[model samples]
Target: MKSKYNFQVQHEDGSVFDMYQMGIWVESFHIYSPNPDRTFLEFPGKHGSYLSASYMKNRKIKISFQVETGSEYELDQLKHSIYNIFYTDQEFIITRDLSPGNILYALQNEEYDFDNITGEDADFNLTLTMADPFVYGQERIGTLADDAGYIDYNGTAETKPAFSFDVLAPITHLDIVSDDGYMRIGDPYTVEETPFEPETIILNDNMNTLTGWGPASSVDGGTVAGQMSVLNSNDFIASDYGSGSAWHGPSVKKSLSQQLQDFKVECYFRQAAYVNPKDTGRVELYLLDINNNVIAKLAMADAWKNMPKNRAEVRLGDTSNNNYMVNTSGKTDTWWNDFQGVIRLERIGTKFFAYVANITRDSASKHFRTWFTGFDDLEGKFQGKVAQVQLHLGCYGTDSAPSQAFQRIKVSKLNQPVTNQVPYIALPGDKIDINFKKSEILINGEERKDLKDFGASFFSFKKGRNNLFILPEGRVSTTVTWREAFK
Candidate 1:
């Protein structure tokens, strides 16, 4: 008696067919045992032979069925349908109750045999070779969320499978889809195993909030009132002082108990109006230690006696009154009044570098007038820690309110990890090909070199979710696609 069984064939293009609907009855299906490829080593002195570990090779499957047709045309159609399954170079997913899971297989050796046709009816046998020896679940285990920032995966089988996802933003979260699973990743706020934390935009205020910063000294600290001091009609931090007073402007500090080794602090400022040569003072930005000692000072002096009229200088200062300028050059008075520039301070090891750039009116242009200054050995005086940052507007010759507007102040750490998420994993023995397009690809926080020469890279999923991140440089979109293999 022919054993009765139900089975379905799913094409590579996602079309499925039930054998019964096509007047095809499955007589029986047989799956051969997995064949393991093994090796042996013989030693001259050893009495017994050594057997190497064995690995299961591809398995073979056979399906026996009969096709019934009422007419010659119908018989031709049924034969063509059966030929469609074996003729094309595509894999088909075959599900059978005898197999523990769905089998991924394709035509084996292009071999098919049929008995003599009797009245448009025929019995046939088909051979198939499993692409992967191990059966896999019909359902995939991972999902890319709508936002593409969150990826979740649930363990479907006891075995581990490789997984991958794309990153469109600086921060992302990869979590195990299990209810009790506790894997959270790609957090920008928390720094893990790295010397420097992620770059933080501590203060990006557009005159909206003024909290946590220290009080302004010579003037009201927060947003200043009046149109004359506005830049592009935006409210800014202003310093107003009466005669006889030297220091003006506001200062903000972050207390650090030796947590930071290297950092970069930057801000933008411009003189609200023109100043007389004699009455013009200096605009200073400096960092101080715990004891209120200046470690570094970036100052622009408006002295008439200077060779170029206005000189912007970077100086290194210590606690013992030792102060010397690292670099100084003349800047035009026109550049001073419209001084929309950025002051950046970078501290690395024992060396400090200062950069000042005069931004052009058209912000789209990268060309800018800039100056750089650097020095070493300043950390010895300040105990190797910067505890305070002060932005000051002062007058040297005369004590008068200097209309200086400050905006776009920011502080960030240097050399921090670009992406802190771990790579998703692939199961052992699974081969996956990942393709990236229109993206600046980074793997494990480093630029992937293989992608530089080629458009795609192949990965062998090593029994886990593979950690992959894609960041689109411009208007381009990022996408990732792959197929999983099983044994």
Candidate 2:
């Protein structure tokens, strides 16, 4: 609320003089200088003030107003004050305020530091969780047909030994609900046998909307467990070998614990058995924030809709697809080929920088660890809004009936940040005084202060440790980050 004026008078000769002046009744000051460029005013601290510069051609003098306090109304009043001052004196026909912008021009053109400041700089840092706990997919059982009286007994007792009737609903049509409202539906499942004869499953194709398997349930889909059970339209099969289809496809329901922040979503998949390379089933890795909003999705060439506006897809290792980096390794077109795709999402502020990488079989094979994807602009543009996270085993577009099967998923948080050490130059014998007001000084094993009641003095240590002492006051006190002074 207080205003003061400073005048730095520079005569024609290379000399300077300082003058202090107070604002007059109208809350304005008028300066008459023969040389407009040579005479200017300076302000203390950084005030939201402006200057308007004008030169009087008639009187060969320059007139400018020094504004100390300015708001919308104050600025208007100052403008009128300058205009009145100019019109009242015919000799000073031209009048204006030396605004900050105008003053900057003068400083740059005349090479003058009106503020006597040194460096002009601005800086900012991008903050994000470098490492999040490695989150893995949690497993639960699907629905079963073990309930009593649910089946229609069609066989009559007259037919020798009565046969048990299995007129129960198909597991494919199974719908399991958790106490927490997590729902999982079983869909027609696909089974692929590898050369090793291991049965690999393709999970979700219909309910691609979900992020994770919602909650855990028993294998029979009876009650809620620590995890969630998948629901489906088909009935659960106990044993089926020939058809290559063992389980019903489940409508994927997202589990809440699967939610995460900055993290890596990965999946391992192989081609379907007895299927051609072009017919190979695809798996997907997806990311969704707490709001159940889809952040991003990645899959093999044939498994996704071509979002020309946002994505590019190609056959694995096909250089012709150019979008696939040269480093991507795998048969350009092959089925049952095991490969791992990883999407590393680094949440920076309201935006995310993602790096997608596809790794092949050979560990020694060279490939680019990542490729650039367009940034995800957050809806609210608020940093750290992301909470829940999930990994997708299957994301639509699978030539096979169901989706691809996933092996394992995991998540982990990084370690704490270490205190950065700052080096300082010091002499063997010097009095180090810290502003903390603690009277303490010891240099080369010698006490610099007579009494140890030093609350604000610096600690004088031997030349080796190079450590700066700091005493924290309270919770609100900022952690000290400084180096000791040296000779």
Candidate 3:
């Protein structure tokens, strides 16, 4: 840490400019303690006015800087850089050594003046007008199961937070009630169905919670495969394991695989992190032989180290051609784009089929696709090892690999239909991001303005513990995220 006078300027793009780095120093800062607006009632011929109510107003700030340069060229270039850095028509952040956790949301909207001498030194002043009366801290995250939830909030002032729902079942409407009233989605919705009938699921894992084979699981660290998957606002993390929070689910054992003939391994998942095509680690939906060798796999990774191109493909026997999007060459650009749901590879009788479903124009449809035809082909060569197989969702040996999240996976020959308990605002595999601060709602990464009820409005959380309930909630989960406020 530097002295109290040192200042740091952070841009929106994560670029930072330090006063000490560029031979610049904070000359001084002129700030008046924040004041409050007051209302008063004056009685006839009264000596003093009666105080009614008071409200804090936005704070104004002014800071001066002195710049010293080594050469005339350096001085000229430095002046232009300073002007461009602070004079942009955007909001930047200012932090001081004196204030460790507080961030000054400074905008160069107000009047400012810049002056410098060509010899070696310069001076300038910056003025800012803050809209919010209180300072804000870092964001805090919490999760709620149904309506009964109790979480500690460490904040002084009232804060408006954003929320996201990882809906577990079908519901007609979602109503979260509080002392004032309730927040609800009143618009009508449609529930889409799978293209085929699913029956006798061999394995099913609802990524809503972290439970693989329940207690006494095994993988890299004696856990489930690709178990390090991440999802937003998810309560089940890498650590939320053990017999206490473990859920009873089905798994594909070695004996079951021996009798299995027509097997369909379906993965309902979403890419938790998609910065670009070339990510840090890859994600895979794979099946292993008795010896833990890769029999077949659906991988999302960069093709090669030399040629770091992003791709999503199905592998038969782990060859170079099979690794770099052979049949899945062009079919996976959409999944790499925004794959809506279900990446599946199954063996019906003797022939193998691969299919993927994606959302195009606000609609999700599974396109029945296959690259392997017979045993003579590259993919069909692995048909002999299909029966003696075990299920694993993530990459082999790479415990903390890809940033993809599996929502619900069902391993069944013929798909089946399961109706919702009741009509709901959202259902299983339906992930929604709702922001009260911005008045925005994104359903499955897309904006949904039509779902807003006639009187649906935004609300905030008060300081300390809040007692609230989500109505019509049987098997639904919601995660709340908020930054604290301070006076």
Candidate 4:
């Protein structure tokens, strides 16, 4: 539209003209506010006038005035009508005065109809019966026995390695030990057939218990991280390593695959020095897939740093299958001690993130970074299947692989997450669209109709002012525009 327009001055507001004189031929009408009193109509004049407008404060329901028609009589009547229409609301209440472009100016105030609107005023509240993203009624997944595991973290040669697989409550702390000397804390070590104490591995809520099994009189200092639980006696693995100085563990599978689509996984680990960053010895957090051999391993050491936690890595699938790795390489300091790392895997897309932390009193060192690997890069590997997950104390090596202890190990599945959106203002005649797939939009005290296909057919604005609800669609909403009466 052209910036300039023509206009003709009609009778002033003080005149006695009973006719609806043309106050200003608005080339374009921009409703600053939908509420009649708080609204400011901006548009170019049909009679050679610029589209500039301004608001007049210090009045009861302050109105924005513009130069047009020069007819005070018509302007006063028009202004009065607009003010009356909004101030005496039939649907909405002009509870707050709004700036010209404030996005919320379009929504009706909560106090619109004192009789219709009950309950405390609230932000957006969505309810879904089919596939709600917010709240669900007691929908539990996975058996109790399928959610917990154990590992050994006690360092020593006199203790036996022990672990559990309870369903009542998932075990979050474990320690496996054995009679051995000199455990590598870094990578590149050969797997050895050593005497491991299968009975010494204990899963407990406290980490100090494992200190007693410390390597032949060494000062044992470690923390048992995460929540704790023990299901039943039959719910554990005795010695899955199976002969020849090996270790074995029963596995637990994640229940909600589709629902846990876009979520995160976190855990903590403390491996023995031999299994550290030197010999590539490390702990196995979880075994996601077994069909195509897609497992996630936490490497103790890589081509990076020399600390067990320094060379921390997340390798998906097996080395033979594309070796998809997300490394937190070279980020080690005092903060790496007793810290947590998170891996956020996106459900829809083949992508994930990793976060690391270093312990510091009541907090942690804020330094953290992540690396991403695409599906195409892992084509020969696997798509996105996470089946079996085991918290192997000493992951890479065999049962004869000297025992490694873990102070704490907890796993939690992220639930429906919330994201914020940019706000925009709606004006009179503006059309809007809202989507409510696994949710419903609640405006005031009622549910809004779904507008997925027909673009906003379920919404209409009153002549003065009104407010409505829009539900979360997991996507951006459609664009809305204002309509002029004459246009």
Model 1, span 60-117: residue lDDT tens? 8788898778887788788878787666565677766454355455555556756847
After superposing candidate 4, which stretches have Cα over 4 Å from the reference?
Answer: 1-261, 271-281, 290-292, 299-310, 331-347, 361-381, 395-487
lDDT of candidate 2 over 55-174, digit per residue (tens):
322111221223343344554454444333223211111112232111100110111111211222111111111011111111111112232111111211100010111212212211
Residues 1-487, model 3: lDDT tens digits: 3335777788744568887777778877655456689999999999999999977787767888887778878888887787777765556777776665666666666655547554777788887666555667876788776466755556766666777777777656676666544577743344552222234656655655444333213322123432343355342223222221122111232323343445677655544324443333334555655555555666444333222233556666544324322345344443343333555676654456665543333332212222332222445556534433333333222222234445565666443336632233455787777688657776765456577776766777776777667766674677888878776
Candidate 3 ranges with C-alpha deviation above 4 Å = 1-3, 7-24, 29-31, 43-50, 70-92, 150-156, 170-173, 186-430, 444-446, 471-476
Q: Estimate each model's TM-score.
A: 0.40, 0.26, 0.47, 0.29
Higher-ranked by TM-score: 2 or 3: 3
On lDDT, the candidate that comes out on top is: 3
Against the true structure, candidate 1 has what lDDT? 0.51
Count of steric clashes across candidates, in order: 20, 76, 11, 71
Predictions in order: lDDT: 0.51, 0.27, 0.55, 0.29
Q: Give the per-residue lDDT of model 4 (tens digit) for 36-77.
A: 224444567655445345323221212222323235454455
lDDT at 487, model 4: 6
Give the Å shift of residue 3 in candidate 4: 76
What value of lDDT does candidate 4 attain over all alpha carbons? 0.29
Candidate 3 vs candidate 4: the lDDT winner is 3
